[model samples]
Target: MFGLPRNRILKKKKDFQAVYSRGKSYANRFLVLYVFRSNGFQGKVGFAAGKKLGNAVKRNRVKRLLRESYRMNQGAIKEGVSLLFVGRKAAVDAGCQDLEKAFLALAKKAGIMAGDVEFSIEKRKNCR
Candidate 1:
């Protein structure tokens, strides 16, 4: 299962709205990230893939990829913040590694990730 727990997820519409309206945002080719400092000690996250992305399957896949990327890099993220990731239409065709890199880049730019940690994706060469 995805490592994100219930307490770590931003579930309500109001929470999402707050992040969207008041939080600082950053984007890359595949994703848009909204980050808000919160009163709580732990970070909370939400993933959104709009209808324009495609059918339910496509949207879910995009969301799953975003969640997985966040889950993988959760440790380096700063506490007391809520993060919301919105997937771009191009994300539907992207691989997980691409999404992960984009997510980490945006998070780092937003100053959410710790400074000492390095987040990088390994390149895979196609074998003929």
Candidate 2:
């Protein structure tokens, strides 16, 4: 591919809850973001779409796009962190690329990018 990084997929309900409860949030035209510290080795990431977004098909599409974006950009994200990508209703109608952009933008706003090196390293080390 285009030399993108791999995404560690988040799969558990409890992990999603942990992020939702403690993570700080940011919003954009199509997405809302939340991030929280993770327990080392058990750290995971997740995504969620509400019923207000649409039926199952649309909601799943939003989730898929968000997950794919997270996967491609994971290398740039801090490790041992749980991230939650929440989809706005508009996201149901938005193009996949646009939604991906929105997620990344929110990630930056939440200070989860490479520029946040010090915080990330500290967070990761603390979790260990």
Candidate 3:
């Protein structure tokens, strides 16, 4: 019930390259975003966690965080866009909230968000 569907993912090397070559990039402290407007009229996303980030376990965990964050916020994005969310080394130890904040910020910067929608679910929390 909480899985990102296959159709919503970009699964080809060439597709990833298309976004890499033609898309505009935006970055924040926690993540890197690449956005390309596509004619397919669907919002497809891909994730990248380089080897330099960490071993398989850490990289995979980061990608999982990114995927869930993006999936939760995907509805706010415009149709016909391909987005790549790249994880930074810092994300290996970061919480989901931090990554989600970075994801939303980058989406806004990329100018792909449907509108000025607010993710006011909690705004912030104190776990202390």
* Per-residue error (Å), model 1, residue 51: 0.3
- Model 1 scores worst on lDDT over the 10 consecutive residues at 119-128
Against the unseen true structure, what C-alpha lDDT does each candidate score?
Answer: 0.84, 0.69, 0.83
Winner of 1 and 2 under TM-score:
1
Candidate closer to the true structure by lDDT (higher is better), 2 or 3:
3
Model 1 residue runs over 4 Å out of place are 40-42, 122-128
Candidate 3 C-alpha error for residue 116, in Å: 1.7
Candidate 3 wrongly placed segments (more than 4 Å): 1-3, 121-128
Write one digit per residue (lDDT tens) for candidate 2, span 2-92.
2322345566677677678777878887988887765742346667899998899989988877776666567777766677788888887
Instruction: Please state the error at residue 62 of candidate 2 in Å.
Output: 0.8
Instruction: List per-candidate RMSD values in Å.
Output: 3.7, 9.1, 3.2
Query: CA shift at 87, candidate 3, in angstroms?
Result: 0.4
Task: Rank by lDDT, highest first.
Answer: 1, 3, 2
User: What local lDDT score does residue 68 receive in model 2, on the 0 to 100 scale?
Assistant: 68
Q: Which stretches of candidate 2 lie over 4 Å from their true place?
A: 1-8, 40-43, 116-128
Model 3 over residues 11-91: C-alpha lDDT tens digits?
Answer: 888888888888889998788899888786257889999999989999999998898888777778888888998999889
State how far residue 88 of model 1 sits from its true place (Å): 0.3
What is candidate 2's CA lDDT for residue 45? 66
Residue-wise C-alpha lDDT for candidate 1, range 67-117, written one tens digit per residue: 888887888888788889999988999988889889888887888887779
